[model samples]
Structures are given as C-alpha cells and as structure tokens.
Target: MYVRTSEVRGDPARLDEGLRLIREEIYPAVTAMDGCAGMSVLFDRNICRVVATTSWRSEDAMWASTETVRALRESAERALGGTGGSEVHQWEVAVAHHDHPVPDGAHARLTWMSCKPALIDRAVDLFRMVALPQIQEFDGFCGTTLMVDRGAGRIVGTAAVESRGAIESSRDAAAMIRERFSTELDATVDGVEEMEVAFAHLHVPEMV
Candidate 1:
C-alpha cells in the first residue's frame, strides 16, 4: 500500500465548494482508476486545512492511475499551488504491527467523521453502545477508535475495515443501530464519510 497525502487551504467562502469538487470530481476519478485501493479526506473549517489520502496496490499502480489523470493533476496544481498553504506528498507503506491481526486480504478505512460539538458525547456513546456491536460483527470488520479534538470539541472517528464493500455495508448496519439508539443517542451527525487506504508499517532497524 502507498499513501498520498495532500494538504490544502482555500478561501473560507469556497471551503465547502472545494470539498465538494474533491469528493465528486477528484476522488472519484482517482478511486475508479486502475490500481487504486482506497482513499480518505479530512478537513477543518476553523483552520482551513484539508488532508486527502489514497492508497494503491503498488507504487506502479499508483503512478498508472495518476498518469491518466493529467488534466486533473494540472488543475489541482494550478488551484492548489501558490495558495500559500498547499502541499502534497507520497510515501511507501513500509511496516505494520498490531496487537490483533488484520483480516485476510483486508484494507483499512480511515474516516474523520465530524458533527456538532453538542453532539460529541452522545456520538461517542452511540458508537460505543450501538455502532460497535453491529460493526464488530461485520465480515470484514476490523476495529475503530476515536480522536477527539478537545480544543475544537470535534471528534474524529478513525476506523479500520477490510474492504470498500465492508465500509459501504456498514452504513446499513449503522442505520439499524441508529434506529435503536436514536432516541437515546440521537446526534446532529453532520457527516460520516469513509476513506479507504493501505496501512504502512514503520519500524526502526534492529541490531545485526
């Protein structure tokens, strides 16, 4: 798996518009291309920063996909460059270590779900009480954890799953859970987006 991380900044008024374009135009083009495994996007309106990522089966496959997206790349370069706050980097998936083994032939989906600050506690609770049980039983289900930005009072749900199919299916599963938990755990869940990515392991060299 390979990681392509892009950092971007745009005018406040155009934030939502830019994100929409990336989701609808840029990402779909990349993900539908050959060799593309998975992808994820994250944005913070307060800070006007965005992080977009995607994974590929191999470095070759990644390049193959990008090679065909020349126009898109050029447009992004023009729109993103010289904005005084934009960058993109590519990295190899080097190493992965985990207390629990990932599912066979499985991939990871990193989602930065954001909702109203008032809904944070219940949102977390909803996942813990309702979402987890259902999601844990998914065939390709891996696991999930939350990263709460205390200062911002925003929550980030970072999840790892087996495949794109699993991520999509989880929605129905979550809906069922929501049906049960909505009364007690209803939240203004503005968005629950998904991104698939290859996980890379990073480790230090050992003594010879």
Candidate 2:
C-alpha cells in the first residue's frame, strides 16, 4: 500500500472545526476516489498538530491524486487556522499487523527514523521479529504499522494502543526497543509524538 501523510500545525481551539471538515468533506471525497484504500487522522491537541493519512492501493493511484489531495489539505489547513505550511510525506506500507480492530478512544505513538537505504530490509525484519513482539507485551496493544520511504531512508512507525495510559506505561520499554533498533540499523531518531486516533477506516484488506 502507498500512503500520503500531511502534517499540519494549527490552532488548538479550531481543532474541532478542522476535524469536522475532514470528516464531512475530505473523507467522502477521498473514499470515493479510485483505488483509495483508507484514510485516518491523528491529532495532538496539546500541540495543535494533526497528521492526516490517506492510503492508496498503488503508488500510481497515490501520485495521480496529488493535485486533488493538495487542494483538500489546503482547505482543511485554512479551516483549522494552520500557521506554517504543511509537510507531506509519501511512503510504502512495509509492515502491518492487525491485533484487533482499532477501538474508540485509541491512541498512537509515532516514531520517526532515518536510516541508510541498504538497511531497509533488515530494519523491517528487526521490527517484525524484535520490536513488534516487545511492544505486544504491553497492555492495550492494538496494532502497529511501519511505513517507509526507501529512497529517502525515512521511516515512520506507528503503534496503536487503547489509551494514553497504555502509551505512558509502555514508554520506557518502547523507547529502549526503538533505540536498540535504531542503533543496529544506524538510524537517527528524529522524534516521537503521542496522538489520539481521531478517525480510522480501511477499505483495503489486511496485509498479513
């Protein structure tokens, strides 16, 4: 699967309005498009940051919808009183595991990493074998997905859990695993953020 993520910084007070527009306007429009697989929104209300992700069946489909997606994003940003320009990233869904359907009140921990292109496959293997198992040991673990930009050596790993408490309790362990994995892969840890899964729906089948 191919995914497009738009990171926007906006006014915290206008978050509700922005979410409303995304659900009422953007969701329907994107889902109706050809080859659309899914769409999800992650929000960090405290920082007024929103990460909107749209998944496509193929790279071509994602690229083809660029203009339309850009316009929709701009509209949402305007409605949300976004200050800085958004940062957009394109990625391949490298690994996906569905432990359970994402529940209401789910929260996610997003970790960003940068590595050498040559180590991409090894990184995936390490995540599947080591990182994933360690994370699953935590309470309220829902599922995890790893998205990568191979050419750019960029990776975004998202771990979804039941609540903020689950995330907090698992933080130390998760950080340790993340640090080890990064060191083994010679990756640089960009940053980590906590977010609430405001919305998520997938039209595509599970990858594994």
Candidate 3:
C-alpha cells in the first residue's frame, strides 16, 4: 500500500474547526476516489497538532485522485497558513500491523505506556531491547519510531507492523517487551487508542 502522512500545526482555538472540516469535508473527497483505501486523522490536544494519514493502491493512483481535488487541497493549505501550500510525503507501506481493524492490506497498532517520571529510562531501555527488535524482525516490519515527551512525562512507542497478522498478534509485541524490558512491575499499559483516517473535501469543487 502507498501511504501519505502529514502534520499540520495551527492555532489551538481553530483546532475544532480544522478537525470538523477534515472529518466533514476533506475525507469524503478521498474516500470517493478509485485508489483510496482508508484514512485516519489524529488530533493531539496536548501538543496542538493534527496528523492525517491515508492509504492508496498506488502512487500514480494517489496523484490522479489528488489532481481532482486541487481546490479542496488548497483550502487545507490555507488552513495551515501556507501560501503555496504543503504536500504530504509519500511512503511505501512495506509492512503494517495494528490492533484496530484495518483494510484488507493495511495494518496498524498503537501501544501506549504510562509511568512515573523516574521510570522513564527503564521504559526506553525496554523498548529498545525488547519491543523494537520484535517489530523489526516481523516479515513486513518497515520502520518504527519512539516518541518521548519529557515535559508531559509521556512515552509513546509506535511500531509499524508488516502485515495483518503482525498487527493482530500484538500480544507477542507486549510479551517481548515484558520479557526483555519490564523493569517496573507497576508499569501498566493504560490504553490502546484505535486510530481512524481523516479525509477532506470542499463544498464547492471550484471554491478554494
């Protein structure tokens, strides 16, 4: 699958409007396209950012569909305070796995760890040795990123799984972490937030 991911930063006050537009307007345009598979949009109140992810059948198909929505795309750019507007980076979805339900070919899983400030290092070490290696070894495991926010005392690890089975069998991902990296018996996984894609479309195709 071909994937496109982008982050847009704007005034916190305007976030709700932005999200509404994405959900109500932008996404519909994409879902109607031929090659479009699925999309999800994430808004981080703590960080004041919106992340939009979409999957497509091919790079050429994505571009062909994109050309049909130039105006709507422009509005999103204006929303993000761009003159020429920003473009999303295209990525090859070599492998993806997730706990949440995904399309036939796509995969996704989000693991969250909540811990006290003191145990932050332990969490990082655990992820490095246990979690990372297991995900890396997966047949379609392409790459993974570990996000740490010391200011908020939050550590979030994101693993891009390679296939549907990899995402479905996430217990193994947790087991790997527990076996190799669980330094704090008290450390617990608070929740696994399911993700959804966000697509946008303008009311008038000609309106910018």
Candidate 4:
C-alpha cells in the first residue's frame, strides 16, 4: 500500500471549518478516485497542526490523483486559515495490523525516526518482531501502522488507542520500547507526538 500525507500548521480557531470542508468535500472526492483505499486526518489543537493522509492501492493511482489532490489541498488550507507552507510526503505502508476498526474516540501516538537508508529493512524487521507486539499489549490498543520512506531513511509509526487516557497510560512503557528499538536499529528519534484521530476511514486493500 502507498500513502500520501499533507501536513499544514494553522490557526486553532479555524480547525473546525477545515475539518468540515475535508469531510464534505475532500474525503468523498478522494475516495471516489480509482485505487483509493482510505483516508484519514490527524490534528493537534495545541500545536495547531493538521495532517491529511490518503492511502492508495497502487503507486500509479496515487500519482494520477496529484492534480485533483493539489486543488483540494489548496481549498482546505484556505478554509483552515493555514499559514505556513504544507509539507507533502509519500510512503510505503511497510507494516499494518488492526485488532479492530478505529473507534470514534481513538487517539494516536506518532513517532518520527531517521536512520541510514541501508538499514531501513532492519528497522522494519525489528518493529514487526519487537515493537508491534509490545504495543499490542497496551490497554486500549486498537491498531498500528508503520510507514517508510526507504530512500530517505525516514520511518513514521502511528499507534492508535482508545482515548487520551489510554495514550497517557501507555507512554512510559512505549517510550522504553521505542528507546530500545531505536538503539538496535541505529535510528535517531526526530520527534514524538500524540494527537486526536480527527477522522479515520481506511479500507484495507487486499494487496496490503
């Protein structure tokens, strides 16, 4: 599976308006496109940051939607009163596992890591064997997805939980495991964040 994420930092006051536009306009449009598997949004009110992610069944489908996506993204930013320029990234869904569909009140903890390009495979293997199991053991754990930019040696891991409390409860343990895994994988932790899963509607593609 392939994923595209567009990140924008904007005013907190306009967040609701942005979300509304996304649901009413962007979501339906993207999902209707060929090979579109799913779409999601992540928001951090405190930081006034929002990220919109779309999953595609194939690379070609993802690339084909670029023009439409560009226009929709511009509309979203305008509605949101977004300030800074957006950052867009493409990734391969290296690992995906779900115990259940993401719930209404789900929250996610995200970690961004950087490592040597040649060690990307090693990082994925370590995550599947060690990190994933540990994460599943946490209370209220719903699912986990690891996205990778192999050429850039970038890995973004998202772990979903039932609520904010669940995210907090698992922090200490999660951090310990993250630290150990980073060491073994020779990865440097760039940033770790927790945010509300503002919207999540992803269909697991057969290919994934």
Candidate 5:
C-alpha cells in the first residue's frame, strides 16, 4: 500500500469551520475518487496543525490522483487559514495493524526516526518483532502504523490510543521503550507529535 500526507499549519481560530469543510466537502470528494482506499486526519490544536492522509491500493493510484488531490489540499489548507500551501509526502506502508474498533475520542502519537538507508530492513524487523507486541499491551491502545520513505531512510510510526489521559500516563514508559528501540535500530529520533485522530476511515489492510 502507498500513502500521501498533506500537512498544513494554520489559524487555530478558523479550526471549527475548516473541520466542517473537510467533513462535508473535501472528504466525500476524495473518497469517491478512483483507487482511493481510505483517509484519516490528524490535528494538533495547540499548534493549529492538521495533517490529512490518504491511502491508495497502489503507487500508480496515488500518483494518478496527485494533481486533483493537490487542488483539494490547497482548498482545505486555506479553509484552515493557510496562505502558501501544504507540505506533501508519499510513503510506502510497511505496517498497519488494528483489530479493535476505534472508540470515541481516539488520540495518536507519532514518532519520526531516521536510520542509514542500509539498515532500513533491520529497523523494520526490530519494530515488528519486538516493539509492536510490547506496545499492544499499553493501556487503551488501539493500533499502530509504520510508514517508510526508503530512499530517504525516514520512518514515521503512529500509535493510536483511546484518549488523552492514557497518553499522559504512558509517556514515561513509551519514551524509555522508544529510546531503546531506536538504539537497537541504530536510528536517531527526529521528533514526536501528539494529536487527536480527527477522523480515521482507513481501510488499510493489516500488514505485519
């Protein structure tokens, strides 16, 4: 599977209206497009940042809709009070797993990492074989996804959970595991993001 992400930092004041436009206009239009598998939105109200991700069944499907998606992305960004445009990225999906239904008020934590391109496969193996099983036991955990930009040696791992409180309580433990995991993969932690799962309708098949 392949994914495209559109990220924009905009006016917090216009957030409500922006969300309305996304729910009513942008979402329906995009989902109805050919080969579009699923979509999700991530919002960090504190930073007034929003990211929308669309999954495609194939690379061709993702690239084929790029122009149209770009136009819609700009519209959505403007609705959120953006001026220039949104940042976009394409990624290959390595893992997307969730068996439980996403409950109300789901949250997600994203960890961005980078390793030598040569070690990408080893990093992936360590994540799936070690980190994942341990994460599944976290309180209120829902699912996780690992996306890669192989050429750039970029990895973005997302952990979906039930609520804010769960996040607060687990930060310490999560950080410890994250540190060790990165060390094992010989990767550097680029950054971390915490946000609400604005909406998740991804039909991303489970990939271990």
Candidate 6:
C-alpha cells in the first residue's frame, strides 16, 4: 500500500472548523476517488496541526489522484486559518496492524524519524518484529501504522490508544522504546506529537 499525508499547521482556535471540513468534506471526496483504500485525520490542538492521510492500493493509484486532491487540501488549510499550503509527502506502507476495529474517541501518538537510506528496511523489520509486539501489549492499545519514504529515508508512525490518559501513562515506557529504536537503527527522532484520531476509515489490509 501507499499513502499521502497533507499536513497543515494553523490557528489553534479554528480546530473545530478544520475538523468539520476534514470529516465532512475531505474524507468523502477523497475516499470516493479512484483506487483509494483508506483515509484518516489526526488533530493536535496544542500545536494546531492537522494531518490528513489517504492510503492507496498502488503507487500509480496514489499519484494519479494528486491534482484532484490539491484543491480539497488547500480548502482544509484555509478552514484551519493556516497561512500557507499543506506540507505534503508520499510514503510506502511498511506495517499496519490493529487489535480490533477502531472505536470512537481514540487518541494517537505520532513519531517522525529519519535514518540512513540503507537502514530503512532494517528499521522496518525491527519495528514490526520487536517494537510492535511491545506496543500491542500496552493497556488500551488500539492500532499502529508505519509509513516510509525510501528516497528521503524518512518514516512516520502512528500508535492509537483508547484515550489521552492512556497515552500519558505510557509516556515513559514509550520513550524508552523509541530511544532504543533510534540507537539501534541509527535514526534521528525528528518530532513526536499526541493527537486525536479525528476519523479513520481504513480498507488497507493488515500486514502483520
């Protein structure tokens, strides 16, 4: 599977409006497009960031719909009162797993990292084999997704849980796992943010 992420950092006060547009406008429009497999949105009020992700069945399918999504993406940024356009990225879905169907009111922690290009595959292996099992064992665990940009050596991962409190309690342990991964994989942890899973409608099959 492939994925595209459209991110906007905007005014915190307009979160609700942004989310409304995402859930009502962008979701339906994008999901209806050719070859779309799934779509999800992540919102963090503290940083005023919203990330919209759409998964595709193939590389061609993902690129084919880019232009059409451009307009809707800009509209989302405008709704958020964002000054500029969205930060966009294309990725390959490296790993995807869920304990159960996602429930309402789930929260997620997103981790961004970059490593040596050659280590990308190794990193994915470590994550899927070692890190993922530990993650699933956490109380309130829901699901996780890992996406990679091979050319850029960049990776973005999501760990969804039942609520904010669950994320808070798992902070230290999560940090330990993250630090270990970076050390082993020679990757730099770029940014980490906790966000609300505004919406998730996935059709991408589980990889693990």
**Tens digits of per-residue lDDT for model 5 on 1-208?**
9999888988999887888888889989998989999899889987789988899999999999999998898888889998765778899999878958677788888898999888888878888998798778778998998899999998988888899988777788779879988988889999888888778887889999
- Candidate 6: where are CA atoms >4 Å away? none
Instruction: Spell out the clash pairs found in candidate 5.
Output: none
In model 1, which runs have C-alpha deviations exceeding 4 angstroms? 67-70, 73-85, 94-208
Flag the better candidate by TM-score, 1 or 6.
6
TM-score of the candidate numbered 6? 0.97
lDDT of 1 by residue, 1-208 (tens): 5655666666656666666666677777877777777665555555455666666777787667655655564455344331643565555442222334345444443433445567666666665666566556765665554444333444444445677687677677665654564445443343554543322221111101
What tens digits encode model 3's per-residue C-alpha lDDT throughout 1-208?
Answer: 5655555666666666777777777888777888887666655544445667666777787677656655665666566443453445555442233432323343444555556767666666666665665776655553454444344345555454445566666656555664444355356664453232232211111100
Model 4 over residues 1-208: C-alpha lDDT tens digits?
8999999887789998998999998999999999999899989988778888999999999999999998999899998888748999999998888887778878999999999999999988888989988999989998898899999999999899999999999999989988998999888999998989988887654222
Candidates in order, TM-scores: namely 0.43, 0.97, 0.49, 0.96, 0.96, 0.97
Model 1 alpha-carbon miss at residue 146, Å:
16
The TM-score, computed over Cα atoms with residue i paired to residue i, of candidate 4 is: 0.96
Candidate 3 global Cα RMSD? 12.5
**Pairing residues by index, what is the TM-score of model 3?**
0.49
- Please tell me which model should have the higher TM-score, number 1 or number 3: 3
What's the CA error at residue 25 for candidate 3, in Å? Answer: 1.1
Query: What residue pairs are clashing in model 6?
Result: none
The superposed Cα distance between candidate 2 and the true structure at residue 55, in angstroms, equals 0.6
Q: Per-residue lDDT tens digits of candidate 2, residues 93-194? A: 988887887787889999999999989988889998998888888789988888899999999999989988998999999989998999999899999999
- Residue 98 lDDT, candidate 2, scale 0-100: 72
Off by over 4 Å in 5: none
